[model samples]
Target chain A: MLLPHWLFSDRAGLVLLAVLAVLGVGVPILNLWVPPDHPLYLSAYTVTVLGKYLCYALLAVSIDLVWGYMGILTLGHAAFFALGGYCLGMYLMRQIGARGVYGDPVLPDFMVFLNWSELPWYWHGFDHFGFAMLMVLVIPGLLAFVFGWFAFRSRVSGVYLSIITQALTYALMLAFFRNEMGFGGNNGLTDFKDLLGFSLQADGTRVVLFILSALALAGGYLLCRWLVSTRMGRVLVAIRDSEDRARFLGYRVERVKALVFTLSAMLAGVAGALYVPQVGIINPGEFAPLNSIEAVIWVAVGGRGTLVGAVIGAVLVNYAKTWLTGALPEVWLFALGGLFVTVTVLLPYGLIGLLQRREKAA
Target chain B: MSELVSELDAAGLHTPIEPVDATHGILLYLEEVTVSFDGFKAIDNLSLYIGDGELRCIIGPNGAGKTTMMDIITGKTKPDTGRVFFGQTIDLLKLDEPSIARIGIGRKFQRPTVIEPLTVLENLELAMSGAQRLDRLITARLTGEERDQIHAVLDQIGLTEHGGRLAGILAHGQKQWLEIGMLLMQKPRLLLVDEPVAGMTPAEMERTAELLRSLAGSHSVVVVEHDMGFVRSIADQVTVLHQGRVLAEGRLEDLQVDPMVIEVYLGAGDAYH
Candidate 1:
């Protein structure tokens, strides 16, 4: 069992994998085998929440791939996430055949309520789980490709690129909120039932989904880690440090940016797809510009340019967010803003950098 | 040797560049080129020819369009009017910066520009002449021969021991040499080096002069430098530019003594010396 040099050398990555493995295997046993009364028993609710955190962690990693490594501060990644959620949500909607309030066998509840006679052309393929899954990867990927092609080709970068990405998610939020867009308006696509013949509400299904989320995070981390370790990864760093130098080196800078952006978006889509089932909702609200910015804050707090830092940051921030929002809901937004400012000013390299410095000092 | 050529060919080392046609003895041709910025001419009716394997020094006062000229040749700036050609067939104006670079023109900026976060070896590797296509880049591993080439460049640039060190940590002179090493990795047909010895110590400048002189016959080297002493040490031919046009073209000795050249440029101050 000789490990590849990249995996062998990565201490943080190994630790991340070990933690994920423990969670993936340990959570299920604790939830299923241990009785509810036992102190060691993990509730299904806790498992679902942990699964949601993994999904957020995956999304943060996706953002780091582009923002941390490629130097494209995309403040619109939530658009990809929401789009992926909507894709899976559509499938779930179809799965609710004759189970909705309107009891329409073919049309979803919203469509029946709106008096639409048939499914939209785009909604036709989502009925099939495989197609829905493919869309989960493709739709966000295609949008990123088209957007990045125009943006990078035109040489839109730095703060301008960031602003445009923010605008992108803002625009999507407005469109998705429209009832005429065919995605469930403000109410969004919810009221899902079973997936692949397994009820999402069941404890077994919940456990499996949590494991899958963990697996997805681990896989996404490895994929990004491998990519950044390659020569292409060096090219990306070169582009980030100096675009002109990369271009003058005869590397196609725009194409690389666009391709990496598309890949990052696809990763976000997978995170979102995993998210929808665990949370049992996919709505326009997910596309809020603040959600995208918060994802970037997670990357910054954990540490930019280190793949493992993103997961740590996302989980820690969301964990704090969960607690803070529960304990002092009025102060959550302020705390988040203060944290971002503090990280930017004091911990420019983020927590990983601080730890690395301490290790060197020791 | 043939196997090596084929290996490099498969690796796309020699694919993008059409062999430069310098049979007529000219490597680069810029004729009647004019570029303007906001109604002011940055380059005014500039006509220049670089002979094959020539070490030509371009000296000019500030606003004389020396940097602008390099920009035009490297496809960074589009000339409003005129013909720019690489060898005889490739119209340089038609290509973008990366394409221009791929087709064998490499430019070093006035300030040293290297990927500081990367190690010196990785910086050189990125600049190596080969398949920069996404698929190739993603899967690219250094062949023994490629590693050898990188080692050769490291030795050439005198950074062999520092290859593993992050480029950002290198001294000013070392970074300049590393940049030149990167250009060497490109295997460029023509090298456009701008102000290579601007802030270097006398010893570093001497080494840089020696390096540029050594690079001439193998690569057509056009050096734009301000330090007259440094320029005199390496320049075989000198082109003096003034107000976006060639003021004089001759040996440095002849240009230094030319009254018109002296009046506009050389007479500026002892600062140039």
Candidate 2:
């Protein structure tokens, strides 16, 4: 398919696609062909890490779309992300089928342990991969639509709206943590054997999933680029700059906001679904408010309005986290906080702004 | 309800709007419209009328409820008691701002409020019909006529050369003109223009006066301005407002001598300047 002209023309976007394409093909080659102990070998663990970062990058892009373009700072965005994961996680659990510890073909291991007789009605079609895939987009999208409809219609915006979104995720976290919810309680859905009858443990499966993650990130980026390039995207920018003026121009401000928010949430959901199999577990912890805030931080530190900046921020921040946690585990939190403050204070437009400044100077 | 039914039937027979009723000679009407903010009457029993295809200029001093009156007409503020009508049929009071705008009333605020990030051309595009706005979002393409309409507005606003520039970078006078251009793009039947020449140069003000003068006959225009010279240049009928009531109303020549109008608005020193 011919991509939007802007995506290929934009230097950062071109660089992003080139890098993703290289990583997509090269990582699998290194992991599969290069022998371990040769120092150049790619480990299974690193593939998972890179794949997970792609997911985070996608999530950060989702936040950037709403917060940067539309002026909607949704702090509860990870609720949609985790909700998408849980939808896929449910399917992953159902895939365990006869292989689970309880070995009940009809019920997941947790349900059997809880003494439930049958699968919940909401869990019916999730056994089918296609149905689960539909859900990964729909559930988060529907939730966002309803939430944004009420919020935008009431004109609750700015920091107050952000606070309400945080309250929404915090509420969901408490609910999902309960055993009665039938989502594996605190343990979450785990012990996935395979996806589509292929052993998930296989090098081929991990490599393919990794490649798929890169494509999904690229696809989502292009889709967002196309959206913002449209007149509607300009309207989103208009709304961010001056909402009342937009309304005066006969644009239904609430409808526009609700639509963008829902779309952004669905993108976040896709990120979450990709995240689950690679990580192998999801729990109420995924619904944590902090996770969503961290996603926003990624967008801010990278560049709020720039699409490639989101991916860069997500990767750079996560990479810093990985290195920090391992190298100075006790000081990780302080270091992360310091990084956020320094970026926000010094590099207000983010690392991308720094690059642009250097480019101008040079 | 009976009149509405008959009007709807007449519109169905015709192409939506029949000629203005000769009995009132009014395209827009306000009767006993009063609104208070914490015991201060922003609009106090403000009865006013505008003839079809007439340009009416309203001049008032500070806190004279000029903005509040526009707010009421555009459905931004609900009057505690009054009737606001567009033509003979539609009740402006009963509608919301969007609906009022849809029903052919457009308002420009005191301050220029352009969507800063969008180009001048894109801002005008957003002000088109809602269907067109949605179409712009889904497809970046535009029909030939829509493109013409945008160029026409750019030319009309005298910003044809700056169509590609972001509105955020425009001068204050340009932003005001851009906003008026946006309102014009909507093709509203009635325009409630506020402070149209607030921060304009003498030359810019002359161009604005000419723009308002030309717009008057095809579109019923209500220009609320503090610039006495600009109002004199364009007003067919002038309304002088004081503490939310029409203190005086006449041709600008006659109102110049009315003691109430002189005392409230054109103070002794504010004369002929």
Return the lDDT, model 1, position A294.
96
Interface DockQ of each model: 0.75, 0.57
Please provide, for model 1 over A1-362, each residue's C-alpha lDDT reduced to its tens digit, 9 standing for 90 to 100. 49888888999999999999999999999999999999999998999999999999999999999989999899999999999999999999999999999999999999999999999998998889999999999999999999999999889999999999999999999999999999989999998999988999999999999999999999999999999999988899989989998888888798899999999999999999999999999999999999999999999999999989999999999999999999999999999999999999999989999999999999
Q: Weakest 10 consecutive residues, lDDT, candidate 1 chain A? A: A1-10
**How does model 2 fare in lDDT?**
0.87
DockQ of 2: 0.57
Q: What are the per-residue Cα lDDT tens digits for candidate 2 across A1-362?
A: 59657675678888998999999999999999998877888999999999999999999999999998998888999999999999999989989999998889989998999999999888899999999999999999999999999999888999999999999999999999998998989999999999999888998899999999999999999888878877888888888988877777766688889988999999999999999999999999999999988989899899888888999999999999999899999997787778789888999889899999999999
**Where does model 2 sit among the CAPRI classes?**
medium
Going through the candidates in order, the fraction of native interface contacts each one reproduces equals 0.85, 0.69
Give the Å error, residue B32, model 1.
0.4
